[model samples]
Target: MAASTKNVSVGTVETRGIEPVPDSERHGHAGQMFWTWFAANISILGLPLGATLVAFRGLNIWQAALVAIVGSFGSFALVGALSLAGKKGGAPALTLSRAVFGQRGNAGPTLVTWLSRVGWETITTTTAAYALLALLGVAFDVRQNSFLTVLCLLVFIACTLLISGLGHATIMWINKWATVLFGVLNLIVMGFLVATVDWSKVLEAPAGPSSGVIAGIGFIAAGTGIGWANAGADYARYLPRTIPGRRLVTASAFGAGIPLVLLISLGSLLTAGDPSLATSSDPVSAINAMLPSWMAIPYLIAAFGGLLMSNHLSTYSAGLTMITLGLRVPRAWAVVIDIVLMFLGGIYFMLIADDFYGPFSTFLTLLAVPISAWIGVIAVDMLRGRDYDPDALMDTSRTSRYWYTGGFRLPAVLAWVAAIVSGLLFTTAGTGADDVWFSGPLADTWPGVNGLGWAVSIGVGAAVYAVFGGRGPITTPASSPALEESVR
Candidate 1:
């Protein structure tokens, strides 16, 4: 058993603020935490629904499955590493960042956390709007236009407020119900398609192999893992200290990684027949093609409910990030703000933001580099046995080890910058001599470079910091209100 609360206090001075809850109250048995994390991590569906439409383009079922597997690993490995590291260190996200960035320097990672929530919210809202319209087409005939999109945006805004206001407990409650509905709907769609589509056609390989199979896998991994990579600590924090780190890793990996590969691969198979599925990118359309028109009612209801469940995640996560950053205001207020902003972002993307998805895809790719850096640095810190207290991450007190030379570690920052630039280069440029000579070498060799950016960013940061900045031994803050926190 872990130490009692009386012994765990920061000092003998026990002024009663919301002093961190004790280990017993905070860290319950692993089973409860496992289910909670599982519920949160299951939201990976939203990503593939919007993202895989672009990635699996023109690929057969086998090819798409292979690609999704690769992608699922990206998320799996990163989260597995983080969860294990955190368990050993006994701290969570912001506190972990303090080890590398210094107590004062933790703001950098926090900013990234905020941006991710905003970006995710925008993407979720925009994509959900698109699907909502498609489902509506099954019942009331309406063309895709600014007016129709506005209506969808209104609905998203309203639901976002509800979910965010409810906080983590309510969101998890909704997720349990939503998961049931999603599983049923997906089964029906996949079952119908399996029965309807000529298996022979889906089994056939593409006339030519994908030029960027590895890249496709990396893309899938990044998308699948993105949620957990940033927020692993959010759920890990709730885990019983008695649970071994290895067990947590296994639970998180199976709960998140395995299912995503299956779901995304199914989506790829779902779209294998229709070359123009992107233009007609509605799940309802996907089912309609599989079954009779009337059958779509049940499927649509299930899908719409699932979409709401997924939307609850973006809103909830966004509120958590905002509150952790210094919104001492009511949780309800934070959610209201997020919903309003998400609504505006939705309208902006549909009405003003042309190429909403193209850039969004690139943005997601680019983010992998920096977020990967944060993960790498923390992993290195833990492995090396440096200070690892989560509560002390931002403490400016003299005993704080996180305040390194000048309160900022140059090595980690440099490594992060390099990773970000590398991701950008690949996202913007294509690989090849022609791309190099005509458009430039960076452009030519970049686009084809699948998971290279993630590998490079994560690897380079870890290597550089390990070799050069390894000398610093510092105590991380146990808890800092200013440091960013992730949602599980």
Candidate 2:
């Protein structure tokens, strides 16, 4: 990447490193986060999330709705708390994570975060590609074949990469309009479903046991919070430190939480009437099917915009995660690398992820575990008031305190590994509740214990890290000459 991309001040300060947002440079409001997260998360993505609870988890509409509302709170709490780190630390979330994970130790969790972004981007890419194919069928009467599918998939990637290639300010602008365009249009579709779907069936849908309900809520929470867990601070890092923590928290929590509740409610409603909700070709198309002929293309365009909006954020964060994981490249170059990696990874998933793909809900639930654990540990670190010096995290040299013992923090690493392993072994990483990928004794004893492992992982990881890791007294901010200079 050229030096030209940095310090332009078009959309941002635009420098690509973990320098602190000096008090003078901090100037944005917390309220902006409302649209930032709301627009980014509220989308067609929730369709499968809601449908999985109703169709696969055996939850009735009310039960699923209850879970959706409740679970999103927990998810966004994690999101908001981590997001608060940005205003306080003025560093990327993964950068702040170096405090807990140490320099090299953070790589473990960073890779997990990177995988989360790639998995999400790939899935959304596939979603948009399918919608493009459907639009072709609806408008141009084009044939659907393997070649067209691949071609459309490539087209979606090209567009996402091209725009994301322009960088952060552009992504923010795109997300702003994308949200406005999609929000009104999708709300109309939701209203149509609300007025049309038969309530009796939704009410009479069979409710499963407590275990399944727990899993359903866990799945939704993970889906709601996973993508943003490691990226919250990335956007907030540029915000003015004058913003109150409460404002930031409320803005992010509800910003993301509200849309999730709405969309998940819509998903549950759709599953109640549409028996094929889980098996639908594409969720937005399923919504368009409910609309009149004139509305299909317009609605499709709106929903596809959601994917573009999401991919922009994900790709941007993937770049930061790469940098956090020691990719010694400019932020712009890292983003380019992130795009290529996600593109190749999308193709790889299209080829083989389905061997294990039972429900999209399952895949998302598994992705959420390590992420939750990561945030949990970070939160505990914050509560303990240990040093989270931004400059230390950015420091490549050994002088930084975060570079603990060969750049690895032992207790934190152990805590992360223990939590993730515990989560995976007991949770249903495979299709069924009884289908533990690595069955634990507790899980084997209880067949319905699908996602207890993930919940446990969070508590266990936080507790262990709190005991072992948060021992140091908080240190004063390290003097950084770099922050005084224009990093751009």
The models' CA-based lDDT, in order, is 0.56, 0.72
User: Which numbered prediction scores highest in lDDT against the true structure?
Assistant: 2
Candidate 2 residue runs with Cα over 4 Å from true position: 1-13, 206-208, 348-359, 432-438, 445-450, 477-488
How far residue 205's Cα lies from its native spot in candidate 1, in Å, is 2.5
TM-scores, all candidates, are 0.79, 0.90
State the lDDT at 314 in candidate 1.
Answer: 56
How many Å off is the CA of 239 in candidate 1?
A: 1.8
Q: What is candidate 1's TM-score against the reference?
A: 0.79
**How well is each residue in 87-187 modelled by candidate 2, as lDDT tens digits?**
67777888788877888888888888888888788778877776787789889999877778778778888787766666656665666676887888778
Worst 10 residues of 2 by lDDT: 479-488
| Highest-scoring model, TM-score | 2
Tell me how far the alpha carbon of residue 93 in candidate 1 is from the true structure, in angstroms, after superposition.
1.9
